[model samples]
Each structure stands twice: as C-alpha cells, then as structure tokens.
Target: MDENESRISALTLGGAQERPMNEKLYMLTLSFSIEGFIRQVLTQKNWEKAYNKHDNSLRLTIKLDIKNNGRIIESIKLIRKAIFFWTRNPKIDHRIWIMIVKDDTPFYPLEEEEARQLLFDFNRDIEIKPEALKKGKNNIAVFVELSWGKHEFIEKNTLKKESNIQQIEKD
Candidate 1:
C-alpha cells in the first residue's frame, strides 16, 4: 500500500486509542434516504453504533408518533407492537423485538432502568427496514433499528437446504 493510504488506514484503525479524536462516527447523522435505510437493515449496519451512543443495554419507555394509515405493512404494525411490549415489559430482549407507537399519548411511564432497557434491546433486529405508506402522507413511516452480532451455530446453507427439503415433505 502507498504511504498515505496506509497512514490513513492506520490512523483510523490501528492504535485508535492513542490518536487524537478528529472524526467520530457517533456524531454523524443516520441516513434518511430510502435505499440506505433498506440496506442498513438488511445488510450494512450503522445503527448499532448509534444505539450504543444513545444508551446501550438500557430499557426504554418509548412513545413515538406512528403512521396512521391502515396498510398492514411490514414496519407499521410490527413497530407499534414492539414499542408497546417494550414499554410494558422492558425486561423483554430488545435485540429481538421492535416497538411502534403513535404520537398521541405521552404517558410512557417506567422505572428509569426499565426505560433504558427499552431503548437498548431495540437493536435485536439487525434488519430494521421501513416502507412508505401507500394511501397517503397520514401514514408516517417510522423505522426502529435493530442489533446484529455473531452468535449462530450450524451452517446457514445446510440449514436452508434442510428446511427446504422438510417443507417439501410436509407439503
């Protein structure tokens, strides 16, 4: 590698602790673009860092405005349910759930600890994607980001093959 490329790479990664802080990913705003959103949820991950910055491992008491339309789409309903569960039972693993809320109410009461966990566990879904409401603008599209990590057993390819064979048998 060239001197400049190697130097920049080293500065950004190697001995990061020793280097003076110039750039901070935490400070950067998340994407509002449609494609960026889909990719981040389905593949690339940038939300996890934001989650950690906000309050890692803290339960949350969320009350965000949800889209009002009745599309019964992927994110609209799922997000609302996730928010309700997290609000009611912050102890639930957020790394596995997503909550959706409407903007009308504000009494998102919970112990401080519970509220923190509410936000932390929200990252369970490494693939948080939101689709625009079809009918009208009244349907506010809110996307709750999720977490991704390395904790899986068995090869995905093998599992997929077995599941496909099993489905055929059942059919």
Candidate 2:
C-alpha cells in the first residue's frame, strides 16, 4: 500500500468544548478499514471474500478513555454491528459522527435522496496512487484533538498580517 492508503486504514479524531452544567463535550470521529482482519470462530480460518452486509457477521468495538494528570477520569466503550456496506457501493461516500454523551444512546439514520447530471472536464492526471485498474475515490484519514483548560499566556506573539504586495515579493 502507498502512504495515503496506509494512513486511511487507521486513524483517530477527538475534541472537547465547553457546555452547560459545567460539563465538557468531547467529539471523536474514528475511521478504519477491516479488509483483511477476519477469522472464523470455529475453524480459525481466514475469510476470503468480499464483505457482504447481508451474509457477513461482523462486530466492531470502540473504546475511548479520558485521562487527566496521569489518572483515568472517564471511559466509554461502544459496540456496534454493521448495517451499511460501503465497499459494495463505492459510488456513494459515507461518514458517521458519534456523539458521546453521559448516557449510552444510539442514533438512527435519516433518509433523503436526489439526483442530477453533470458535465465532465478532462484535466491533467497526477500520479498519486499505485498503477492499477481501480475505479473509485481515494480514502483520507485525519485525527483531531481538542482540549479545555486554563489558557496559556504567550509573551511575544509572532503572528503578523501581510499584504498582497509583500506576499508576491516573498514568492
């Protein structure tokens, strides 16, 4: 696999913000691919086929642990079964946003659909992936973390604004 594909296979996202009741709201978006990590429970045999939501039985568990000052503050584990199969439908992209609350609650999907036609424009092709006869989009994984605490004071700020003339000159 290439560098971008490798990154998309595993990643993490986290953030925290102030909320009512003196509580902090933390949001995390985790994305991963389990293309080759499946085995049979009885025979211990590796699965060798495209994952089908109708036939395949898979379980995913996500655990989040919050720590403060080298000690465990709060933790949560979410277990979910696969419902939508994205690999089979590569024409559509998917994204899931999980909101972690004090109580364990599951969310549902909203249904809406539309269609439109578009013109195609040919452009210069940039070689970013391995040469292959694949027809789909590239996967991207990004991790973000947000924290809350006493704001740190900076003595000398180096940030400055520059005009277009200055930018052109520097370039």
Q: Say which candidate scores most in lDDT.
A: 2
lDDT of every predicted structure (CA atoms) = 0.23, 0.23
What would the per-residue lDDT of candidate 2 be over residues 83-146, giving only the tens digit for each residue? 2233333433333211112123432223211100000000111111222112333232222121
Error of 2 at 100 (Å): 18
The whole-model C-alpha lDDT of candidate 2 against the native structure comes to 0.23
Q: What TM-score would each prediction reach against the true structure?
A: 0.16, 0.28
Off by over 4 Å in 1: 1-33, 36-45, 55-97, 102-171
Per-residue alpha-carbon lDDT of candidate 1 for residues 1-171, written as tens digits (9 for 90 to 100):
322110001001011111124531111111111122212222102223334344222121222222224332233222211122222355543333233232233233333333323322222111112222232223222233322222121111100000000000000
- Least accurate 10 contiguous residues by lDDT in model 2: 113-122
Model 2 Cα shift for residue 168 (angstroms): 40
